[model samples]
Target chain A: MRNQLPLIIVFATGLLVIVTFFIPHEPFGSLEQRFLVWYSIVAGFTMLLGLDSLVRYHLIKIRDRRSGWGYSLVLLSGLFVTLILGFYSWARYQSPFKLGSPFMYLYSYVIIPLQATMFALLAFFIASAAYRAFRARTTAATLLLVSAVLVMLGRVPLGGWLWQKIVSLIDLLPGTNLSGLKGLEVFARISDWIMDVPQTAAKRGIYIGIVLGGIAMSLRIILGIERSYTSGS
Target chain B: MIVNIIGTWIAAGLTIAILSFLYKDNPLYKFAEHLYVGVSAGFGVIYVWAFDLKPMLIDRFIENQGVERWILLVPAVLGLLMLSRWFGKIGYLSRLPLAFTVGIGAGLGITASIQGFLLPQIQATLLPLTTINNIILVVGVITTILYFYFSRDFKGPFKYLLELGIIFIMVSFGASFGYTVMARISLLIGRIFFLLSDWLRII
Candidate 1:
């Protein structure tokens, strides 16, 4: 009963939604929005489950004097403090002190910087990963390397200037008009075309597959066929 | 004067404390991190209550007495059903709510596909192709699409055309990357200026 029920629901729901798209009936159009709100409520509650697990894990670690007990303490303490401040301020609906509160300061200065720094780390990581991948070992790799180098160069002003020079030299021959707005327009057109066509098509194909897969998965879940995410598992 | 001065000082101190993590983790960073999370959560809850729930549910459905009052019960019931997860014996009952959510999401996704993907793409393809720029665009689109066509292998001249399409794409991507990097650099510069000028009042 536990296993089969969810799968049945999932499949039924998935099929309904798929059909709903073509139907364009009154309730069908609103079906998605209704689901979104329900999902949000469920998600909000699931966050509490996460918090419970986090607290339990940290408390156990702290009790056992684990290696990173201190860090765990920091995480828990942060979680609780935030929860308290958030709840209090939300319930009261008053400024939790003056206009320029400590909370505001922490948000703008500390949190923002931390978030930005984490994102900044991606640039360095990408560079390192690209270095490893872009080795000129084979024909395909060489092509990749050449493309990578050109793209890297084309990004900079110096690289653009060099490209312009090469383009102008090529243009000296008959039939090539590579100067001013015509050149810029051609470049922009080429770039836009690449993005709109290949990138968009590939992305769309992947997205379609993902959507279909999701439908299948959702069907499985709703029909009580997939009990994996449930507690019984 | 007192509040402004104190606020600025608090901001400066917190900024330094957070930035100290760039050097390495410390007690100061931990303090700031905890405080930030707590306050952010508090504020977020308030925002949701005021902006989302108040207008949508309370004012419109309950107090303002809209026709959608009965419809509101569906979500409320679902929300209650989610709490079933907390119980051990009847936890499977949560699937009812989960099913409703999945159904709705699937419906929405299929609908959005038409507007977000199909319409925009068709509009793009319908552009005039007589001009040099338009011709380049048309060629680029066809060639790039062919580059991605893995249904069959590109032999002979087809391979060369694919190569040219790839180069154009790469150059475009490079230009985008350069712009993005400059934006990040500018942001970093701005932050530095904030520290030097507003926080320190040195300027």
Candidate 2:
């Protein structure tokens, strides 16, 4: 009974939502909105769960005197301070002395730079990973190496000069011609074609199957038939 | 004038602190990293409550007295139920919220699949192949798809053909990467220009 109930619920709700998309009526139009509201509520509650986990984990680390407990303390203290300030600010509404006033300063000076730094780390990681992957030991690797070098060159001002030289040389061939305008136009056209055609087509096929599967899954949940998310059954 | 000067100084100081990690890990970077995470999380929660829940839930339920105010009860119950996870015996109650979340997520995924993925892809592929450039695209598509076909055993000539397909894909990917790198480099250059010209007023 436990298993059957949830499964039925999921299939039913999933099917309704999918059908709702096509119907576009008073209730159907509101279906997505209702789901969003539900999502917001659930997300808010889940955040408390996340906070509990964070606090518990750090507390354990501190108790155990784990490596970097000092950092953890700093983290917990910051979290508490921020939470107090946030709630205080919200309660006071437009109060000039609200704790949340310092938040913008903290974000501008601290958070943005950290995010930028993390992204910057990607460049070094990519270089290292590419170096290992692009070894020219086989036919495939050799092709990769050549393409990488060409693309790297083609993107820069130096690449433009090189392309011009190559185009002029090709033009010199008997009864054959390649103008700079023609070359540039052809390159741009090819690039756009590559992005729009095969890439888009491949992504589309994967997406369709995913949608159908999701519908089936959601239907299983909303109808109270997919109670696997609950305990016991 | 004072605010502008202070802002410039803060920017320069933070930039230096972040850049210091590129040379080696330091206490300054660690401090900034922790402070960043803490402040960001705090601000994010506030924004969520103010922008999302305030107008959507609290205002509707309390101030406006909307008919759908009763809908707030459903989530409010679920939210209270979730707190039951803190207790050993009632922890199972938390599953109610989890199930609802998964269901909604699944519905969204189903909708997004049709809109975001399938239609655009089919349209893209079925586009005109009459032009010379389009013919190249058609060849690239067919060959690349063949290259990915894993079920059939590929012999010598077929292997060679697949290799050619792989080369085309690699070239395309490399070009994309090169473009991305150029963008990042340009951004870095822009920042340096700002520091020199606007901040210092010495360009």
Candidate 3:
């Protein structure tokens, strides 16, 4: 009965949602929104479960005097301090996100900069990868390299200046009639086309497959065939 | 004003600390990383309480009357039951809430996939083959879909179609990569701007 009850609940709720999708009656019409509200509230508690796991891990590391326990100490201190400030802000101002609040200050200074810098670090890594891996060794590789370069050029201001200079140089050469097709606009047009037609086609093909797979998986879950959730995986 | 200046300097120091990881993994980067995880988690807890629980559940329960007020108890109970997982004995009870969430998720996925993804994508793909672009679009979609069809060995013309599909896929990936690189570069630029303009007053 341990597993069966959950499975039954899954089936009932799944079927209920599916059935109500077609109905637009007064109660049923608002049912999905109502369920969404309930889901968010439940999901909010799940965040506490996550917070428990994070805190426990750090606490264990610190207790055991593990290799990076100092860092864990830093982490726990940051967490607890932020939490105190957040709750204090909420209590005093009725919103944790009030302007000029300590929580907001930490958010603006610490979180924003840290997260942005973290992602910004990826730019350097991507550049390193481009230098090593973006070789045009084969037809497919060449196509990829060419497209990437064209798109990159189409995006940046430097690309326009370079394109104009190249066009001028080409015009300087004897026996050349490049008049109207003169700037980075050509690259932009090609980039747009690449994104619009072929890219759309490929993405649509992938999306169709994903949708079909999702439907099948949903069916499996609804039927209780997919039991990974209950198994704690 | 003094507080703002101190905050800017702190932000700059953190940004520099994170950026130092590009040179080599160091203690500074590690400190920043750990602090980031903690702060983000703390923010999430407050966010969930503020946005989700406080407004949706507690406020709604307090504001509504009769059945509506009482109905909020169902989710509140389910949420509490999820917290029961922390206890060794009542952990099994958590599965009920998990099951409920999964069921709702699956139901939503089925309908949303059909309405949002499948039909729309199919409709988008169904273009007249009059123009060369249209022909390419139609053929690209068909061949790409056919590429994933591994039921039988595709010999002769089908083989070429599969190859064409891969080319289309590769082009799409290339475009995606280019866009991603640009986005990363822009983010980097933002950081640089903050460092130079906000922190150093150099720009």
- Which candidate's DockQ is highest? 3
Residue range A188-217, candidate 3, lDDT tens digits: 777888988888888788778777888999
Q: How many residue pairs clash in each candidate?
A: 22, 18, 0
Report the C-alpha lDDT of model 3 over B103-125, residue by residue, as the tens digit: 88998988777887788888877
For model 2, residues B1-203, the per-residue Cα lDDT tens digits are 67556766776565566667777898767766666566666666777777666667777788655567777888778777778789878676666666566666666667766677656655665648788656655566556666776779789888876765676666566555655555655555555565677567788
Off by over 4 Å in 3: A175-179
lDDT of 1 at A50: 52
For each candidate, what TM-score against the reference? 0.68, 0.77, 0.97
The Cα error of candidate 1 at residue B54, in Å, is: 5.5
| CAPRI tier for the interface of model 2 | acceptable
* Model 1 per-residue lDDT tens digits across residues A1-233: 76566556566666666666667678776765555555565555545555566677878999999976776677666556655654565455455433345445445544565555434434544556557656667555555555445434544455656667777888899997767632453433443454454434334434444555555665555455655654441
TM-score of 2: 0.77
Report the error of model 3 at residue B85, Å: 1.1
lDDT ranking, best first: 3, 2, 1
Predicted chain B of candidate 3, TM-score versus the true chain B: 0.96
lDDT of 1: 0.58
Worst 10 residues of 3 chain A by lDDT: A177-186
Off by over 4 Å in 2: A1-9, A81-101, A142-158, A161-233, B1-11, B63-66, B138-169, B183-203
